[model samples]
Target: MTDQPPPQDQPPTPPVPPGNPQPQYGYPQAPPPPAPPQPGYGYPTAPQHPYAQQPGYGYPAQPVTVVAGSGGDTRRGENRTIALIILAAVVAIGLIIGSGVWYAGSSHGGGGTAGPGGGKNGTATVTGGKEKVPANPAADVLFKVPQPKTEDPSVPTAGSWLSGRVYAKSGIAEIIGYDPADGTKKWTLKFPGPVCAATERVTADGRTGIVYQPSMPTKTSRPGCTQVAAIDVRAGTELWSKSIGTGEFATQFRNVTVSGNTVAVGGSDGGAAWDIGTGKVLWQPKPGDGCSDAGYGGGPKLVAVRKCGTYGNRTLSIQNVDPTSGKVISEYKMGAGIEYAGIVSTDPLVVGADAGHSASGGSGVSDYFSIDNRTGRLLARIPVSGDAYEGECDTISQVEECKGVVAGDGKLYLATKERNEKKAHGSTNEVVAFDLATGKQTGQRAAAGDSFALFPLRMDGGNLIAYKKPPYDKGGQIVSVDGASFRSTTLMELPAAGADRDLQTDFQPGYSEYRYTQGKFFMAEPNVGKPIGSFDKDRNLFVAFGTRD
Candidate 1:
């Protein structure tokens, strides 16, 4: 999950003037040695080795007098002793690194025993493989566990897998790794303060690392989310960190996101992009440029938005750029009324836009249109109306909101509110699919139960992952809807862990912090508003769902 970086307890750093660049920070190039396992986060503790308890004296130094032995023999004997000491030192160092690697990786859904460094030290005692999810969504149960929590439920939670463990940031100030086999703590990396923005990315080896900015709130007189850092997921090692000046209005930037080889920070005044492998600033657009703010689209493109013209007649330019060089590749312009315009898919060059307020008050509709990716010519348009288009249900209500438009499989799926006599919590809506090429309804509607609430999450295994929760239901249910047939099947039922009672005022389920990245899925609810004490332990419920092995 992400936001503008949070404020720090220390004083604010001055802003770096527009042209001057900030210094970059990076660690030595190594194959990133494994992360050292921390205590009590569901990782195995290091065991006490037998050699550690031995006396300092090595090999009980035997007295070898040069005078007592033959002259040539004495020199050779002394050389052999020195060589032996060096060999022992090398072996000892290897053992230490090996022990750290073992503790870091020993908890991947398999039983592990306490090893050399675990006993007396207050390190965490871990048992792995307890929690597991089926490889297929059609199976019995993926998994149900306590939700990992964050102080602010509004903040997004991002997930990744490292060393066969699930690493996620569910709470502020901490990024945790869980054993997906069963939801158990694998390891946790606690920041010095709360984190404002955090994101995780998996590399080729399946190892994931998180790039985050520590708590440096932007509301203060000296506003900035100055420090951006990356840590290894397996061992929490600070891979690299740097203070890139986010200017004054840092909160405008969205969560730190890693798309491909670049990790980007968004802001109204033109954000910055950095190479994920190295802490090098790849590019940053000058503020007031036609396209200032940017978000990642699929493939190698980035969507950039900027506003121009006078108050009476305003124009919004949405441009697609080459992320590696920040060069504008294609541009599309539309009038001011269209809001929330974003590129939803790459192959079809589809864009979604909504107009919350029209000339005659608010227009209760959201539009989706496809354009030629290269020429920016409008190809097709699809509009959805009803309560769903008005941003779903109510502003202050605790009901699950519907994600109106989702693009998948060369078609645009729109969730519209259906006028039905039965009214409960969640939307009784029909999801209609439109052919991307012609904008005509396919005449297929996804089967929705009487209690179906609308929230299309993402495209999973060629199916759209939808969310449903009936009034007074035990827990939310995740449905896998076939994009072609419009058939909906209940995949798994989310447990009612941190759900609030439906006592009118307290009924809105704020569990929107769930995420599906790569192949891993994790969702959790907020436990505590502010962490108590060490930020180590808090009773929270979270579940990790994945395909069965």
Candidate 2:
């Protein structure tokens, strides 16, 4: 019973079509901006990065690699990236403290050697969390490039860089020296054009941060041509720029992130990196590839979800890309019932939601896994509980009524889906929370019509954020739960502002159930939900909507 709601007169996909109208999501639709279709619950290759991964889990032993080059995901949700050897990984050190295990070497082992500009010595820290960033992380070396010279200080103005926020209280968006605390503007700086996506990266300096902005493709005739701009948090100006794949024919940018002085990106052809300051091309493969995955962010190391040619009747390829040189270091293929779910967290590692084919090859298997970027390892994995589908009476068709799993912090929390079972049995459905850290059952809750599986809210400061769907009579308040203690609290109704509303409106209501962090919390509204995934701690939890000049 996939949580997909049946549209008006839309033929229900396979198995057993639910009896009546779309059950759970009781929502009205309005003409909004046309939304990209829910990313086929996948990217063509593997998973894209925002340097975020699913949390509450362990790492995987296997790496997901396809031949390479990923594209497609109208349903591409708000996935972001981490960048610079001025790396986010070092900032992510705060994350390892909670894993309950500290070792002499990272699962990926002595991180990959730094590429050009990765530091005169080569190599710096970057971040990726969505995939199983295990032992062999793609080289947390977000920067092999050297740092740039300081720019002449100037008055704050539009285009200057701000810390994390996009605009100044003065209503001006800076390219550098913009402060998040106030609307202070810095120098006049325009980031690279047609910014496709952007995010905040923690730098070596307390006041310094990195932002990666990808521009729209131009009408050129190159194969790989794109620009990645690195801005100074204190000054809001361009530190450097690198031309990625040709921008003309291939305009789609898979992911852009900064790890220290390095800026990595997965493009329509392959993954590439540049020294944040020197603007040196780090690495490039002979044929080159777009990236293995499409939803995660790109940095020193990039995990791609690719479709290696049809072999053995399976098509998915998962591999790690060296963003700097564009060389693929690790690769593996995904087959048999595995489908890209969504990102769990952004820093420390990458996370994913994957479904396996059932015994009948129809009923899907729901499990979650965490990846260590360096090793391409699976840190943790948790399968859904049997009772997860036990509620519905009568043989509920696997199709038309199956609910899957969502990952965050090593825990694969799945909402219960039993066809008319709750109503038939006069019982409420429940949500089964599985602990992937130890493959143990933590708890469960009674629910009704568990439709679109709600994902984890987010985890920070050892606290996990999530939403309590209404089927169980729970308020849609943003709930906070202690990671170790499993304590829960209702934060707020969260602001539904920004483009998220537009995206949400595209689907039936009963399907969405995510609780995460992106700062921007208010005492009166301490829970302003961001549109994208925010897993790393350095990422300031702030609020933002489309901006106006």
Instruction: Please provide, for model 2 over 1-549, each residue's C-alpha lDDT reduced to its tens digit, 9 standing for 90 to 100.
Output: 012121112112234221111111112322322222212111111112121111111112223332222321211112223111100010000010001111111111111122222221112221221111112211110111111111211111111122344332111122333333342444456543323323333344312222222432234521222455565554445566555335343333434555555555543233445566676666422132222233233322344444321211223334455444434454334433232332333233333323332111122233434454445455555443222332111011101111243335555455443333332322333334555555444543323222212324334444444443332222223334434444333333322445333222322222221212332221111011222323411221122221111
lDDT of 1 at 58: 9
Work out candidate 1's RMSD over C-alphas: 25.2
Q: Evaluate model 2: give its TM-score.
A: 0.45
Compared with the true structure, model 1 gives a TM-score of 0.58
Clashes, model 2: 168
- Superposition error at 233 for model 2 (Å): 4.5
Please write out the lDDT profile of model 1 over residues 1-549, one tens digit for every residue: 001122212212222111111111111222322333322211111111111111000011111111111111100111111000000110010000000001111121111112222431122121211122223322122454433454432232333334445544445556676665565666776654344444333444333333334442233332334455555555545556655445443323333455556656543334566666677776653433332343444333444443332222223445555555555556555434332344555555666544333111011224455665565555666544332321221100010112345666766666544334233333354555667776666665553445444456656545676655443454455555655444454444434444321211121222234554433455553222333445324334344555333
Candidate 2 weakest ten by summed lDDT: 85-94
TM-score list, all predictions: 0.58, 0.45
Residue 412 C-alpha lDDT in model 1: 69
Span of 10 residues, lowest total lDDT, candidate 1 = 92-101
